[model samples]
Target: MHLTRTWTPPGAYDLPGSLAVLARGPYDPTFQVHAGSVWRTTRLRSGPATLRLTPAASRVRAEAWGAGAQEVLDGLPALLGEGDAPEEFVPRHRVVAESHRRHPGLRLTRTGRVLESLVPAILEQKITSIEAYRSWRHLVRKFGEPAPGPHPSLHVVPEPRTWVRIPSWEWHRANVDSKRSDAIVRAAGRSSRMEEAAAMALPAALARLQAIPGVGPWTAAEALQRSNGDPDAVTVGDLHLPRTVGYALTGERNTDDAGMLALLEPYRGQRHRAARLLTLTGLHPPRRRPRRQPGDITRL
Candidate 1:
């Protein structure tokens, strides 16, 4: 079944910038950018679907195919960030204010599919993005079915049961360590409860996610930011975000998570949005050490 919709946002909307966070990497099998439209494949509760979004003047054109096509179209508004209230976010810092002014079209996207975000967030735990992206691409392409759309290369993300059934060796082949793989399997086992978190309050949703072993504040926050379009789901434990937010706000190169939170205290209900704007400023403290290279676990 093919479905289509045209959505006009209440305010400015950045199609590429808003959806950029959902793409794991350039080679992600479930996401793509071709011919001025963004293509994404996902497994909905009803079934798998492929969605293509094209931005036109003052509106976005959305098209979908497969059993979940109607469901995808129904949620198009929320998926494109119609639920986010960016105007209420008052940027306290100059850097944040400038970024907000510069990127008026930027809005947080809410896919409302917890497992879609949770699995990827779990894979990214304590690993280089290169490693995480590589593993996700390998696993999905190897296990997932072809997307039901014109884009032949695009593939839908695997269902929770499929994720749970991936053997140990395949994960190792994808360079995924036992810990992350185990977490994915556990999360998949509880996929129903996890998906329910999408409709819960942010704090409750976060707690629900963290109830799974190996999932923590960072992972929970990362998942909800996309799944719920939570403006205040501040990622508390990241390798570089604290430094980036701190330096951007206070010119402090040594600020930790606590200090970063303090700096963002003014934007209590929109801390994540504030941090996002800060990062968009392209300000980062000078690196004091060599960049961490992606690890090769397949050799292990």
Candidate 2:
């Protein structure tokens, strides 16, 4: 009922960084991070599955359990960024170059599951990550199934049908606003098409996703970054990214989405990769004061 596989990074790979991208938030329900291992429970096409990744001297050892164990094993390489070519990047900024040099092993992961990403991405729209994560955690704990085998403590994300069926009251109780909750329900209803869309070319895939009412450029970009390890999928409409990118690239504290795109034009085919490398450096735009917190819609 369990399977184990091994993968060695092509040259150098940051196992933690690759996995970190999949963790929706620090309090994410589905992805669990431990001292030296990463645990993830997913509802695969085959069935629910759990994966534990442990780093070794030169490679990672992956153990999976459940009906979808083989699927998880097959996708392990892509998830760990086996297909990503980080060495080929040529950064235009000195700080970015330093980050790439420091973490030559950085790689982008591809999950190949759109609905899974879509649900959380919807919950995350226009809200602080903490708020979104809290809602996600509440929903998953209430609906997700227990992880198979000895990993009894972990939980897999609920199936698409379950997502569609979650009552409006439950969503409100989870502190999810009407707009996001409705979008998730609609997306869950069309989860199959979204999964099929993942096999298409990036442009087509995004278009198919955006066909849904609530999916937009930002949500599509975020999903594609995980679903396909899209190198060029730069996230727009982010509250802080433009400033962060602009400040790091040009030392300008004020910038917008258009400005961020303009500044990243030099690395057109690898904008997301560039942005991620910049973030790894822990550089941020200078802040004058703390930003306002997200409103508690559940209270209203």
Candidate 3:
């Protein structure tokens, strides 16, 4: 069955920018940009669905197909960032203020599907983006079901049970190491509990996610940032975020996580938003060292 909905945002809205965070990479099977609309596939509580969002004059037109069509249609507002209060975010640094001013329509998106975010976040742990995105693309294209809709190429992410049952060789073929694979399996085993965290307070939700084996502050924060639209879920252990944030905020070339936090103290309740604004400014310290190469685990 097909379903449709149109939503008018309360203020300025950047449709593509809000949903861009959900795409694992440019070639993500579950997400695509066709024409001017955004096409995305997801496994809702009811079932799998494909959603197409098109920007109109002053609103968005949404269409969905499959068993979960109604659910996806119903959640379109939240998914497009109706739940996020971008106005509450006050940028203390000049760069942040400039980014916030330039991208007034920018809003954080909340998918409200914990496992969807968690699994990809797990795959990204301590790895280059190239490696992590390739693994995600390979695994999803192999295991995920074809999305329901006009777009034949889109695919819905696998269910939790399917995630648990993926064979070891398939994972290896996808270049997923055992450590990350094990974490995905473990998290999948408790998918119901993890999904429930989407409704809990941010701190409690983060704690619940981190409770899973091999999940840490970084992973939990990454998951919640999408699943919950958590404005303050600042990623703490990233390889480049601290340096970028420090340089944008203080012109410091060697700021660690602690220093980054200190610089962001003024934007306590919206630290992640501040970090995002800093990143949007394209301000980063000059690279003095070679970039980390993407690992080729299949050779090992």
- Quote each prediction's TM-score: 0.99, 0.97, 0.98
lDDT of 2 at 75: 95
| Residue clash pairs of candidate 3 | none
Candidate 3, residue 299: how far the Cα is off, in Å = 1.9
Instruction: In angstroms, give how far residue 116 of model 2 lies from its true place.
Output: 0.7
Looking at model 2, residue 289 earns an lDDT score of 88
State the lDDT of candidate 2 residue by residue for 4-32, as single tens digits: 99998878777887879888777676788
lDDT of 1 by residue, 1-300 (tens): 998899998988889999999999998999898889999988887888999999989899999999999999999999999988899988787788899999999999999999999999999999999989999999998988899978989999888899999999999999999999999999999999999999999989999999999999999999999999999999999999999998987788989999999988999999999999988999999998998999998998
Give the candidates in order of TM-score, highest first: 1, 3, 2
For candidate 3, lDDT tens digit of each residue in 1-300? 998899999989999988898999999999999899999999999999999999999999999999999999998888999988998987776788889999999999988999999999999999999899999999898899999988978888988999999999999999999999999999999999999999999889989999999999999999999999989999999989999988988888889999999998999889998888888898899999899999987988
| Cα lDDT computed for each candidate against the true fold | 0.93, 0.86, 0.92
Model 3 stretches astray by more than 4 angstroms: none
